[model samples]
Target: MDPSQFSSQPPEAYKSSGKSGMPAAPPPAYQHNPAGYPPSFLNQPVPQGPYTQGPYPGQPAVTVQPAVFVTAAPLANPVPDYLAYSIFTMLCCCLPLGIAALIYSIFTRDANNSGQRELAEKNSKTARTLNHVALGIGLVVIVVIIISQIVIRTAR
Candidate 1:
Protein backbone atom coordinates (compact mmCIF):
# COMPACT_ATOMS: atom_id res chain seq x y z
CA MET A 1 0.00 0.00 0.00
CA ASP A 2 1.24 3.57 -0.76
CA PRO A 3 2.22 5.59 2.36
CA SER A 4 0.34 8.60 0.95
CA GLN A 5 -2.88 6.45 0.63
CA PHE A 6 -2.37 5.11 4.18
CA SER A 7 -2.06 8.70 5.55
CA SER A 8 -5.28 9.81 3.77
CA GLN A 9 -7.40 6.79 4.99
CA PRO A 10 -9.32 6.85 8.30
CA PRO A 11 -8.11 4.63 11.25
CA GLU A 12 -11.40 2.55 11.12
CA ALA A 13 -10.79 1.77 7.41
CA TYR A 14 -7.25 0.52 8.19
CA LYS A 15 -8.49 -1.66 11.11
CA SER A 16 -11.47 -3.09 9.09
CA SER A 17 -9.28 -3.94 6.04
CA GLY A 18 -6.75 -5.84 8.30
CA LYS A 19 -7.44 -9.41 9.68
CA SER A 20 -10.89 -8.49 11.16
CA GLY A 21 -12.55 -8.27 7.67
CA MET A 22 -15.38 -5.96 8.94
CA PRO A 23 -16.75 -3.00 6.97
CA ALA A 24 -15.45 0.50 7.91
CA ALA A 25 -18.08 2.79 9.52
CA PRO A 26 -18.60 6.28 8.02
CA PRO A 27 -16.51 9.15 9.52
CA PRO A 28 -18.31 11.63 11.84
CA ALA A 29 -19.53 14.87 10.19
CA TYR A 30 -18.64 18.36 11.61
CA GLN A 31 -21.72 20.57 12.30
CA HIS A 32 -20.76 24.27 12.63
CA ASN A 33 -23.17 26.51 14.66
CA PRO A 34 -23.87 30.09 13.47
CA ALA A 35 -23.52 31.32 17.11
CA GLY A 36 -20.02 30.33 18.30
CA TYR A 37 -20.86 30.28 22.07
CA PRO A 38 -23.91 30.83 24.40
CA PRO A 39 -25.28 34.44 24.34
CA SER A 40 -24.91 34.95 28.15
CA PHE A 41 -21.06 34.58 28.24
CA LEU A 42 -20.36 36.30 24.87
CA ASN A 43 -22.56 39.40 25.54
CA GLN A 44 -21.05 40.18 29.00
CA PRO A 45 -18.58 43.16 29.06
CA VAL A 46 -15.09 42.84 30.70
CA PRO A 47 -14.54 44.91 33.88
CA GLN A 48 -12.03 47.82 33.69
CA GLY A 49 -9.69 49.65 36.19
CA PRO A 50 -7.73 48.65 39.35
CA TYR A 51 -10.85 48.71 41.57
CA THR A 52 -14.13 47.12 40.42
CA GLN A 53 -17.64 47.36 41.83
CA GLY A 54 -18.99 44.50 44.03
CA PRO A 55 -20.49 41.47 42.27
CA TYR A 56 -24.17 42.24 43.24
CA PRO A 57 -26.01 45.25 41.70
CA GLY A 58 -26.14 48.67 43.57
CA GLN A 59 -23.10 47.68 45.78
CA PRO A 60 -20.33 50.28 46.40
CA ALA A 61 -17.14 50.15 44.33
CA VAL A 62 -14.10 48.57 46.06
CA THR A 63 -10.96 50.70 46.58
CA VAL A 64 -7.36 49.38 46.76
CA GLN A 65 -4.89 50.86 49.31
CA PRO A 66 -1.12 50.91 48.86
CA ALA A 67 1.01 48.68 51.12
CA VAL A 68 2.84 50.22 54.12
CA PHE A 69 6.09 49.07 55.84
CA VAL A 70 7.69 50.05 59.16
CA THR A 71 11.25 49.50 60.39
CA ALA A 72 12.97 50.14 63.76
CA ALA A 73 16.17 52.19 64.09
CA PRO A 74 19.40 50.52 65.24
CA LEU A 75 20.33 51.09 68.90
CA ALA A 76 23.37 53.29 69.60
CA ASN A 77 24.69 51.11 72.49
CA PRO A 78 23.20 47.64 72.58
CA VAL A 79 23.35 45.67 75.84
CA PRO A 80 25.78 42.74 75.88
CA ASP A 81 24.47 39.20 76.46
CA TYR A 82 27.79 37.83 77.93
CA LEU A 83 26.90 34.34 76.76
CA ALA A 84 30.45 33.22 76.03
CA TYR A 85 31.72 34.50 79.40
CA SER A 86 28.91 32.68 81.21
CA ILE A 87 29.62 29.46 79.28
CA PHE A 88 33.33 29.68 79.99
CA THR A 89 32.78 30.26 83.71
CA MET A 90 30.24 27.44 83.84
CA LEU A 91 32.66 24.99 82.20
CA CYS A 92 35.95 26.03 83.85
CA CYS A 93 35.21 27.88 87.10
CA CYS A 94 32.42 27.07 89.62
CA LEU A 95 29.40 24.87 88.78
CA PRO A 96 26.50 26.57 90.70
CA LEU A 97 27.48 30.21 90.08
CA GLY A 98 28.39 29.42 86.47
CA ILE A 99 24.99 27.78 85.92
CA ALA A 100 23.27 30.87 87.38
CA ALA A 101 25.38 33.10 85.11
CA LEU A 102 24.49 31.03 82.07
CA ILE A 103 20.78 31.30 82.91
CA TYR A 104 21.03 35.10 83.30
CA SER A 105 22.95 35.31 79.99
CA ILE A 106 20.11 33.43 78.29
CA PHE A 107 17.57 35.76 79.92
CA THR A 108 19.61 38.76 78.68
CA ARG A 109 19.52 37.40 75.13
CA ASP A 110 15.75 36.76 75.36
CA ALA A 111 15.08 40.28 76.70
CA ASN A 112 17.22 41.78 73.95
CA ASN A 113 15.28 39.86 71.31
CA SER A 114 11.97 41.03 72.86
CA GLY A 115 13.08 44.72 72.67
CA GLN A 116 13.05 45.11 76.48
CA ARG A 117 16.07 47.38 76.95
CA GLU A 118 15.94 47.70 80.75
CA LEU A 119 15.37 43.97 81.32
CA ALA A 120 18.18 43.06 78.96
CA GLU A 121 20.56 45.43 80.72
CA LYS A 122 19.61 44.04 84.10
CA ASN A 123 20.13 40.46 83.00
CA SER A 124 23.42 41.32 81.37
CA LYS A 125 24.69 42.92 84.57
CA THR A 126 23.58 39.94 86.64
CA ALA A 127 25.31 37.50 84.28
CA ARG A 128 28.52 39.54 84.40
CA THR A 129 28.45 39.70 88.21
CA LEU A 130 27.84 35.94 88.54
CA ASN A 131 30.69 35.16 86.15
CA HIS A 132 33.06 37.44 88.08
CA VAL A 133 32.16 35.88 91.47
CA ALA A 134 32.46 32.35 90.08
CA LEU A 135 35.86 33.10 88.56
CA GLY A 136 37.12 34.73 91.78
CA ILE A 137 35.97 31.77 93.92
CA GLY A 138 37.55 29.32 91.45
CA LEU A 139 40.88 31.17 91.66
CA VAL A 140 40.81 31.20 95.46
CA VAL A 141 39.98 27.48 95.62
CA ILE A 142 42.81 26.67 93.18
CA VAL A 143 45.28 28.72 95.20
CA VAL A 144 44.24 27.01 98.44
CA ILE A 145 44.58 23.51 96.88
CA ILE A 146 48.07 24.33 95.52
CA ILE A 147 49.24 25.68 98.92
CA SER A 148 47.85 22.63 100.77
CA GLN A 149 49.57 20.20 98.34
CA ILE A 150 52.89 22.02 98.76
CA VAL A 151 52.62 21.97 102.57
CA ILE A 152 51.67 18.27 102.60
CA ARG A 153 54.66 17.32 100.40
CA THR A 154 57.04 19.35 102.56
CA ALA A 155 55.71 17.70 105.75
CA ARG A 156 56.18 14.22 104.25
Candidate 2:
Protein backbone atom coordinates (compact mmCIF):
# COMPACT_ATOMS: atom_id res chain seq x y z
CA MET A 1 0.00 0.00 0.00
CA ASP A 2 2.53 2.69 -1.17
CA PRO A 3 1.16 6.29 -1.26
CA SER A 4 2.87 7.00 -4.70
CA GLN A 5 0.55 4.42 -6.44
CA PHE A 6 -2.68 6.01 -5.07
CA SER A 7 -4.68 8.13 -7.55
CA SER A 8 -8.39 8.77 -8.26
CA GLN A 9 -8.21 8.35 -12.11
CA PRO A 10 -5.34 5.78 -12.39
CA PRO A 11 -3.06 8.74 -13.55
CA GLU A 12 -2.97 7.48 -17.20
CA ALA A 13 -6.29 9.08 -18.18
CA TYR A 14 -5.75 12.27 -16.12
CA LYS A 15 -4.58 15.64 -17.59
CA SER A 16 -3.00 18.47 -15.58
CA SER A 17 -4.68 21.83 -16.08
CA GLY A 18 -2.39 24.91 -15.64
CA LYS A 19 -5.13 26.83 -13.88
CA SER A 20 -5.41 26.59 -10.08
CA GLY A 21 -9.16 27.26 -9.45
CA MET A 22 -9.21 29.74 -12.39
CA PRO A 23 -10.05 29.50 -16.11
CA ALA A 24 -7.17 28.83 -18.57
CA ALA A 25 -6.35 31.18 -21.48
CA PRO A 26 -8.04 30.44 -24.81
CA PRO A 27 -6.30 30.34 -28.26
CA PRO A 28 -5.43 33.68 -29.91
CA ALA A 29 -8.11 35.10 -32.22
CA TYR A 30 -7.27 35.35 -35.97
CA GLN A 31 -7.08 38.92 -37.16
CA HIS A 32 -7.79 39.89 -40.78
CA ASN A 33 -5.30 42.24 -42.51
CA PRO A 34 -6.76 45.36 -44.10
CA ALA A 35 -4.86 44.50 -47.33
CA GLY A 36 -7.15 41.46 -47.79
CA TYR A 37 -4.20 39.02 -47.58
CA PRO A 38 -4.63 35.64 -45.88
CA PRO A 39 -4.11 35.48 -42.10
CA SER A 40 -1.37 32.86 -42.61
CA PHE A 41 0.74 35.52 -44.35
CA LEU A 42 1.02 37.63 -41.21
CA ASN A 43 4.51 36.22 -40.54
CA GLN A 44 5.56 35.78 -44.16
CA PRO A 45 9.11 36.81 -45.09
CA VAL A 46 9.79 40.38 -46.16
CA PRO A 47 12.83 41.81 -48.02
CA GLN A 48 15.59 42.87 -45.61
CA GLY A 49 18.52 45.32 -46.05
CA PRO A 50 19.13 47.98 -48.70
CA TYR A 51 19.96 45.74 -51.63
CA THR A 52 16.43 44.55 -52.43
CA GLN A 53 14.28 47.58 -51.65
CA GLY A 54 16.70 50.53 -51.53
CA PRO A 55 19.36 52.09 -53.74
CA TYR A 56 22.18 54.58 -53.18
CA PRO A 57 21.57 57.22 -50.60
CA GLY A 58 20.06 60.60 -51.71
CA GLN A 59 19.27 59.35 -55.25
CA PRO A 60 15.97 57.89 -56.41
CA ALA A 61 16.73 54.92 -58.65
CA VAL A 62 14.82 53.98 -61.78
CA THR A 63 14.85 50.25 -62.58
CA VAL A 64 16.00 49.80 -66.15
CA GLN A 65 15.30 46.72 -68.29
CA PRO A 66 17.78 43.93 -67.46
CA ALA A 67 18.00 42.97 -71.13
CA VAL A 68 19.67 46.32 -71.94
CA PHE A 69 22.89 45.11 -70.31
CA VAL A 70 23.66 42.54 -73.06
CA THR A 71 27.04 43.95 -74.03
CA ALA A 72 30.16 41.85 -74.82
CA ALA A 73 32.92 41.74 -72.25
CA PRO A 74 36.11 43.46 -73.26
CA LEU A 75 39.10 41.15 -73.78
CA ALA A 76 42.13 41.36 -71.43
CA ASN A 77 45.86 40.61 -71.91
CA PRO A 78 48.93 41.45 -69.81
CA VAL A 79 52.63 40.81 -70.44
CA PRO A 80 54.06 39.15 -67.37
CA ASP A 81 57.37 40.75 -66.24
CA TYR A 82 59.11 37.46 -65.38
CA LEU A 83 58.61 36.07 -68.89
CA ALA A 84 60.13 39.14 -70.52
CA TYR A 85 63.12 39.17 -68.14
CA SER A 86 63.86 35.49 -68.71
CA ILE A 87 63.90 35.93 -72.50
CA PHE A 88 66.19 38.98 -72.47
CA THR A 89 68.45 37.52 -69.80
CA MET A 90 69.03 34.31 -71.80
CA LEU A 91 70.00 36.21 -74.97
CA CYS A 92 71.90 39.34 -73.86
CA CYS A 93 73.46 38.06 -70.56
CA CYS A 94 73.36 41.69 -69.44
CA LEU A 95 71.43 43.42 -66.64
CA PRO A 96 70.50 46.25 -69.05
CA LEU A 97 68.35 43.75 -70.98
CA GLY A 98 66.15 43.72 -67.91
CA ILE A 99 65.44 47.41 -68.56
CA ALA A 100 64.26 46.62 -72.09
CA ALA A 101 62.08 43.84 -70.76
CA LEU A 102 60.61 46.16 -68.14
CA ILE A 103 59.81 48.74 -70.79
CA TYR A 104 58.04 46.19 -72.97
CA SER A 105 56.07 44.87 -70.02
CA ILE A 106 55.02 48.37 -69.03
CA PHE A 107 53.87 49.24 -72.55
CA THR A 108 51.91 45.99 -72.75
CA ARG A 109 50.40 46.57 -69.33
CA ASP A 110 49.16 49.94 -70.55
CA ALA A 111 47.84 48.44 -73.76
CA ASN A 112 46.03 45.74 -71.83
CA ASN A 113 44.35 48.31 -69.58
CA SER A 114 43.21 50.19 -72.69
CA GLY A 115 41.38 47.10 -74.02
CA GLN A 116 43.87 46.23 -76.79
CA ARG A 117 44.56 42.68 -75.66
CA GLU A 118 45.06 41.27 -79.17
CA LEU A 119 47.92 43.65 -79.85
CA ALA A 120 49.51 42.89 -76.51
CA GLU A 121 49.27 39.14 -77.04
CA LYS A 122 50.75 39.45 -80.54
CA ASN A 123 53.74 41.41 -79.30
CA SER A 124 54.33 39.07 -76.37
CA LYS A 125 54.36 36.02 -78.65
CA THR A 126 56.65 37.73 -81.18
CA ALA A 127 59.17 38.58 -78.48
CA ARG A 128 59.30 34.97 -77.29
CA THR A 129 59.65 33.64 -80.83
CA LEU A 130 62.46 36.03 -81.60
CA ASN A 131 64.30 34.93 -78.47
CA HIS A 132 63.98 31.28 -79.49
CA VAL A 133 65.38 32.01 -82.96
CA ALA A 134 68.32 33.90 -81.49
CA LEU A 135 69.04 30.96 -79.18
CA GLY A 136 68.91 28.49 -82.08
CA ILE A 137 71.31 30.63 -84.12
CA GLY A 138 73.76 30.81 -81.22
CA LEU A 139 73.70 27.02 -80.85
CA VAL A 140 74.29 26.49 -84.59
CA VAL A 141 77.32 28.80 -84.63
CA ILE A 142 78.86 27.02 -81.63
CA VAL A 143 78.40 23.60 -83.26
CA VAL A 144 79.89 24.74 -86.59
CA ILE A 145 83.00 26.13 -84.86
CA ILE A 146 83.48 22.90 -82.86
CA ILE A 147 83.20 20.74 -86.04
CA SER A 148 85.72 22.91 -87.94
CA GLN A 149 88.22 22.65 -85.07
CA ILE A 150 87.92 18.85 -84.99
CA VAL A 151 88.53 18.61 -88.78
CA ILE A 152 91.61 20.85 -88.57
CA ARG A 153 93.16 18.71 -85.78
CA THR A 154 92.49 15.49 -87.72
CA ALA A 155 94.35 16.83 -90.78
CA ARG A 156 97.43 17.75 -88.62
Candidate 3:
Protein backbone atom coordinates (compact mmCIF):
# COMPACT_ATOMS: atom_id res chain seq x y z
CA MET A 1 0.00 0.00 0.00
CA ASP A 2 3.11 2.30 0.21
CA PRO A 3 3.56 4.44 -3.02
CA SER A 4 7.42 4.42 -2.93
CA GLN A 5 7.51 0.63 -2.36
CA PHE A 6 5.53 0.02 -5.54
CA SER A 7 7.45 2.65 -7.69
CA SER A 8 10.81 1.80 -9.41
CA GLN A 9 12.07 5.52 -9.48
CA PRO A 10 14.03 6.95 -6.48
CA PRO A 11 12.28 9.25 -3.93
CA GLU A 12 14.46 12.28 -4.86
CA ALA A 13 13.56 11.94 -8.59
CA TYR A 14 9.86 11.78 -7.77
CA LYS A 15 10.19 14.98 -5.68
CA SER A 16 11.87 16.97 -8.53
CA SER A 17 9.81 15.56 -11.51
CA GLY A 18 7.12 18.31 -11.11
CA LYS A 19 4.49 15.61 -10.41
CA SER A 20 3.32 17.71 -7.37
CA GLY A 21 2.43 20.64 -9.74
CA MET A 22 4.69 23.18 -7.85
CA PRO A 23 7.89 24.90 -9.28
CA ALA A 24 11.24 24.35 -7.54
CA ALA A 25 13.29 27.35 -6.41
CA PRO A 26 15.94 28.51 -8.92
CA PRO A 27 19.32 26.72 -8.55
CA PRO A 28 21.79 28.50 -6.29
CA ALA A 29 24.02 31.08 -8.15
CA TYR A 30 26.82 29.35 -10.11
CA GLN A 31 30.30 30.06 -8.50
CA HIS A 32 33.00 29.92 -11.22
CA ASN A 33 35.93 30.18 -8.67
CA PRO A 34 35.51 28.16 -5.46
CA ALA A 35 38.45 30.08 -3.82
CA GLY A 36 36.01 32.69 -2.38
CA TYR A 37 37.14 35.71 -4.50
CA PRO A 38 34.27 38.21 -5.05
CA PRO A 39 32.29 38.00 -8.37
CA SER A 40 33.35 41.62 -9.22
CA PHE A 41 37.09 40.68 -8.98
CA LEU A 42 36.58 37.54 -11.16
CA ASN A 43 34.63 39.61 -13.75
CA GLN A 44 36.36 42.44 -15.73
CA PRO A 45 35.64 45.68 -13.79
CA VAL A 46 38.00 48.57 -12.84
CA PRO A 47 38.27 48.99 -9.03
CA GLN A 48 36.61 52.13 -7.59
CA GLY A 49 37.52 54.38 -4.57
CA PRO A 50 40.82 54.76 -2.68
CA TYR A 51 42.40 51.50 -1.50
CA THR A 52 44.33 50.74 1.76
CA GLN A 53 48.16 50.25 1.68
CA GLY A 54 49.24 46.70 0.81
CA PRO A 55 51.31 44.41 3.12
CA TYR A 56 54.41 45.64 1.25
CA PRO A 57 55.16 47.84 -1.81
CA GLY A 58 57.31 46.43 -4.66
CA GLN A 59 58.94 43.62 -2.54
CA PRO A 60 60.30 46.10 0.07
CA ALA A 61 63.44 48.29 -0.38
CA VAL A 62 66.86 46.50 -0.07
CA THR A 63 69.88 48.45 1.28
CA VAL A 64 73.41 47.12 0.72
CA GLN A 65 76.55 48.91 2.02
CA PRO A 66 80.08 48.41 0.67
CA ALA A 67 82.98 47.14 2.84
CA VAL A 68 85.77 49.49 4.03
CA PHE A 69 89.42 48.53 4.74
CA VAL A 70 92.01 50.54 6.72
CA THR A 71 95.80 50.12 7.12
CA ALA A 72 98.50 51.99 9.14
CA ALA A 73 101.54 53.69 7.58
CA PRO A 74 105.01 52.10 7.73
CA LEU A 75 107.59 53.25 10.32
CA ALA A 76 110.04 56.07 9.41
CA ASN A 77 113.65 54.81 9.08
CA PRO A 78 116.39 57.14 7.84
CA VAL A 79 119.95 55.92 7.08
CA PRO A 80 122.70 58.42 6.22
CA ASP A 81 125.95 57.95 4.16
CA TYR A 82 129.15 59.31 5.78
CA LEU A 83 131.08 59.40 2.47
CA ALA A 84 132.13 63.07 2.80
CA TYR A 85 133.47 62.62 6.31
CA SER A 86 135.23 59.39 5.28
CA ILE A 87 136.95 61.15 2.35
CA PHE A 88 138.13 64.01 4.61
CA THR A 89 139.51 61.43 7.10
CA MET A 90 141.40 59.54 4.37
CA LEU A 91 142.98 62.69 2.85
CA CYS A 92 143.87 64.63 6.03
CA CYS A 93 143.73 62.00 8.80
CA CYS A 94 144.69 58.33 9.45
CA LEU A 95 144.83 56.14 6.32
CA PRO A 96 143.70 52.77 7.79
CA LEU A 97 140.73 54.08 9.82
CA GLY A 98 139.69 56.35 6.87
CA ILE A 99 139.61 53.33 4.51
CA ALA A 100 137.39 51.38 6.96
CA ALA A 101 135.07 54.40 7.30
CA LEU A 102 134.76 54.69 3.52
CA ILE A 103 133.88 50.98 3.15
CA TYR A 104 131.19 51.24 5.87
CA SER A 105 129.77 54.38 4.17
CA ILE A 106 129.33 52.46 0.86
CA PHE A 107 127.77 49.50 2.69
CA THR A 108 125.30 51.82 4.45
CA ARG A 109 124.06 53.32 1.16
CA ASP A 110 123.76 49.89 -0.55
CA ALA A 111 121.92 48.29 2.40
CA ASN A 112 119.47 51.24 2.64
CA ASN A 113 118.68 51.09 -1.10
CA SER A 114 118.23 47.28 -0.93
CA GLY A 115 115.61 47.61 1.90
CA GLN A 116 117.88 46.27 4.68
CA ARG A 117 117.08 48.99 7.18
CA GLU A 118 118.74 47.43 10.24
CA LEU A 119 121.95 46.63 8.34
CA ALA A 120 122.05 50.14 6.88
CA GLU A 121 121.69 51.71 10.34
CA LYS A 122 124.51 49.52 11.74
CA ASN A 123 126.86 50.34 8.83
CA SER A 124 126.22 54.07 9.19
CA LYS A 125 127.06 53.93 12.88
CA THR A 126 130.30 52.02 12.15
CA ALA A 127 131.30 54.61 9.52
CA ARG A 128 130.84 57.47 11.99
CA THR A 129 132.88 55.66 14.66
CA LEU A 130 135.73 55.00 12.18
CA ASN A 131 135.75 58.69 11.13
CA HIS A 132 136.06 59.81 14.76
CA VAL A 133 138.93 57.31 15.38
CA ALA A 134 140.75 58.54 12.26
CA LEU A 135 140.41 62.18 13.35
CA GLY A 136 141.81 61.35 16.83
CA ILE A 137 144.82 59.46 15.38
CA GLY A 138 145.50 62.26 12.89
CA LEU A 139 145.53 64.91 15.65
CA VAL A 140 148.03 62.85 17.71
CA VAL A 141 150.36 62.38 14.67
CA ILE A 142 150.25 66.14 13.88
CA VAL A 143 151.18 67.08 17.47
CA VAL A 144 154.10 64.64 17.50
CA ILE A 145 155.45 66.07 14.16
CA ILE A 146 155.15 69.65 15.45
CA ILE A 147 157.06 68.82 18.68
CA SER A 148 159.86 67.11 16.73
CA GLN A 149 160.17 70.09 14.37
CA ILE A 150 160.35 72.57 17.31
CA VAL A 151 163.07 70.47 19.06
CA ILE A 152 165.20 70.29 15.92
CA ARG A 153 164.94 74.07 15.36
CA THR A 154 165.93 74.77 18.98
CA ALA A 155 169.00 72.46 18.70
CA ARG A 156 170.14 74.19 15.49
> What's the lDDT for candidate 3?
0.79
Candidate 2 residue-wise lDDT at 15: 42
Candidate 2: list runs displaced more than 4 Å: 1-115
Top candidate when judged by TM-score against the true structure: 1
| Model 3 misplaced regions, further than 4 Å | 1-77
What's the lDDT for residue 130 in model 2? Answer: 46
Query: Model 1: how far is 134 from its true place, Å?
Result: 0.4
Residues 1-156 of candidate 2 have per-residue lDDT tens digits of 898799653464334355456654555776644443333444554444434554444679888776655443334445542455545655554344444554555555655666677766765665554445555655676789899999999999
Candidate 1: where are CA atoms >4 Å away? 1-76
Cα lDDT tens digits for candidate 3, 6-117: 6744557645565766775555665564343334443444334445232232477666699987643332565887999999999999998999999999998888777778
Ranking of all candidate structures by their TM-score, best first: 1, 3, 2
* lDDT-better candidate, 2 vs 3: 3
What's model 3's TM-score? 0.50
